[model samples]
Target: MVPQLYCDFLQPDTTARHTFTVKPTELAYINEHLHHLNHHISNLIELRSALLHRSNQLTSPTYIVPHEVLSHIFNQANQMEWRSPQQAIVLSAVSRQWRQVALGTSKLWERVICQGPLKLYRDSSLLIQHCASYASSLDIRLLEQGYKLGAADKTFDTTTTVLSSSDVKGKLKALELQRIPSPQWIHMLPSFLRLESLSIISGHHPSVDLSSLPLSHVYLNGSTFDSLILPPSVLVLHLDDYFLDYAVILLRKCPRLIEFSSETYILTRAQLPPNLSNPLALNSLEKLVWYPAQWFMELASATGLNIPVINNLELKDSEGLKPAPFALLCHQISASLESLTLTYFSANDDWSIADLRHLFTFPIPTLRKLSLTDWSHRLILNAICALTPDEGEDGYTDRCLPKLEYLSISSQDEIFGLEFDFDYRVLNLVKRRRIGEDSPFHLDFSFCSDDDADYEAQAAWQPELLHELKEFVANRPVTITIKGGEVELDQLSTARFDDGDCSS
Candidate 1:
């Protein structure tokens, strides 16, 4: 379909045997046609690119999701996984559409976490500014670089400047500051009107006055309480690695506390507050978690601090707890207590079977759930044995925790030197508890061991015990789980139960 002049122009030199001359006008015409063709080809290429883009948009899975729904998904992701401004940047970099959605989603920029060196915080100022622009309320976390940086550091000044900014200060709701050497920034706390939750984990023991703020939840770790002032509005308080005396001081101040946890209280020889003729009652208190120590017992006895409505109690590191004090504390709160968790108890000479029995001798009829974790085999066995009902001369009667509906026990070490009779005892306890109960009874036991010999021994007896228990509770409202040495008997029973075979 080519014209003669055009073909001659397109031919290679090797194909041209004779000299063929043409008019300059004909050559210009050929050039003009080639330019038109080139322009048409450019347009076709552009058309192809547009079609491919359109096809990709139609086939992409995320393309079907509306912009608002996609933004909500990003918001949730930002809350759960990405609690930093960097998350916003990474999300915006995914695609053009995602960038638009992420930048537009105000909730996605609500929480900004800045950790590492001062330089990092300085560099992230623009991101923080962007976050502050989009979000009405913000939760910010600023973790200091490992070393001590003084108030004189330029980075610290930059941080203070950003936080003192009109937009960030008014919208801040929750703030967590960790390991910053200078407590000078504590002066800015009262300026944050919207701040409700504050966590300060520093050894500086800054004198903080929170009485003017409307804080509801406060967590202080490795911080002193000598000069700290708490507001009456606080609902939940967590004091970690603090002196018992300091905790008592704080507790005495917060009358409306609903939940209070104090971990690893440092025992002090200094006497606590003198015993009041009338008990300092926390009638509003519902939950109490603390390390069981002699000082706490003495303090409770001396001050007569009453948590009459306390329903949940957890005692951590109760390995060597004395009997009389433990029993006394339990008896005081036994009337309303519903759940009890005892953790980190190991084998100790002082923690004998009789001690545990003595502690539980007082009836906690209101108790419904009990959990024991990281306890020695002997202690766990004794605790369960104490709970197991003995065949009295009259009839079978429940001993302790008679109304318990849930029991969970776990140990990380091997049940060394204990017989398989332990498992039998557990089975007996389950059978006795679930006999005529219409309510569901749940028992979970985990005694995983890393030793090969222990694993083999457990493997040998676990299947037989699991089969017996499964067959017995086949049609009852009882759920029993036993996990030994890396293997979960619950899964095995479930598989067999699904297959309609309870005997295997």
Candidate 2:
């Protein structure tokens, strides 16, 4: 509504009679200008008040993100390398109102990580305090930051003896540490009170043994084998290359081991136990694995129990070199097997597709995940392709994969063979041309011994032929993992290249 004075003074014909210094016309003009200025200021004030009111409504009340989302964010924070602190920074800068909300929320600040820029992990007990009663899994990785291992024996710079320091109270499920002090360190492990899964990562440190630890499930690095005195009642034991010698210990001690794996380890003749009173060790064991194949023994001794509950068997390229022995070993595996893999254990026998097929003949009725590596992919996929006809009229696809969920094949060993190639036979693949001649290829798939670039270089190699050999993968229905870690042993699996997707 217009003010009465505004309407009266704005009329040109009317005048401010109270003004004696000027005429009524001049007074009318001055009054009009003042009225217009007042109207504009009032409009601006009303707009500012409205904006302020709406902002207050937003700042008030509990602004909560769902717990499921918060939990997911926490999980990401726990696993993130460079993203956690950035997230905290972004939240802090949203606004003063939001800053208060974020600062007051102790749950968001509780992810205590070690080795971060802030170095909250130096004193775990203090970090744990911030978590209070809501602490979840605690993952502590021992790093090679300062200490170094002796060439022969394992040593620790700091002996975690007070032992009270490592002790953790709560439902601790996972404990990850690197460059652990020694076998005794695992015995004195602080989180052992109630740990469900434990990983000992010894990056460049000597291997330490853990045969005697009471953990239910154990994952070990190859260098962690400084020494191990396994507990007889152990259930699940995973040994990397470091524990290849300890396989005998596993056989003797962990009778109840349901699952076991190694990176690349050798069951050398040197470590082969003198088939003593316990001629058959690991009798109660179930799942068995040796990845990045080294060498396979025929295991021809008609002794040892039929791995009863064992379902997964990963045969790496190394398995191909010792084909006869490995094949014979598979015959003794559990009849209820669900997955079978023939991966590039290492460069042995040039890892031929045809050779692998010759070994794996018996059908595993319960097999679901069938995987292979290098030419083994062609071998396994060819078998699956044969088993599953292009048309569904045959029972190949129908009865073949009734229980199967995943099938993966990797080709990481194209440059190298599955098993160890003696200095010469490797040249045969390099010289051989692709089955088809009219193919245009650019990269050479030939294996050569370059001495310093240190590889064995191919002298007269065809580029097209090599590319075909390197990238020739058939799209099969099964989930495939064509690439895997490098570890050569009897099993050489770091080679899940053919193993089902463990990432999910």
For model 1 the local lDDT of residue 234 reads 93
Tens digits of per-residue lDDT, candidate 1, 222-265, equal 86634878889899999888777677788877889999988764
Best by lDDT: 1
Model 1: residue 21 alpha-carbon error in angstroms:
68
Per-residue lDDT tens digits for candidate 2, residues 242-315, read 53345655545667777777655445432444554444555465566665544324231423434666787765
Off by over 4 Å in 2: 1-112, 116-125, 132-167, 181-187, 203-214, 224-227, 231-234, 265-270, 279-286, 292-305, 345-360, 376-504
Candidate 1, residue 396: the lDDT equals 31
* Model 2 worst lDDT run, 10 consecutive residues: 473-482
Error (Å) of candidate 1 at residue 116 is 3.2
TM-score of each: 0.73, 0.51
- What is the C-alpha local distance difference test score of candidate 1? 0.67
Whole-model lDDT values for every prediction: 0.67, 0.44
TM-score of 2: 0.51
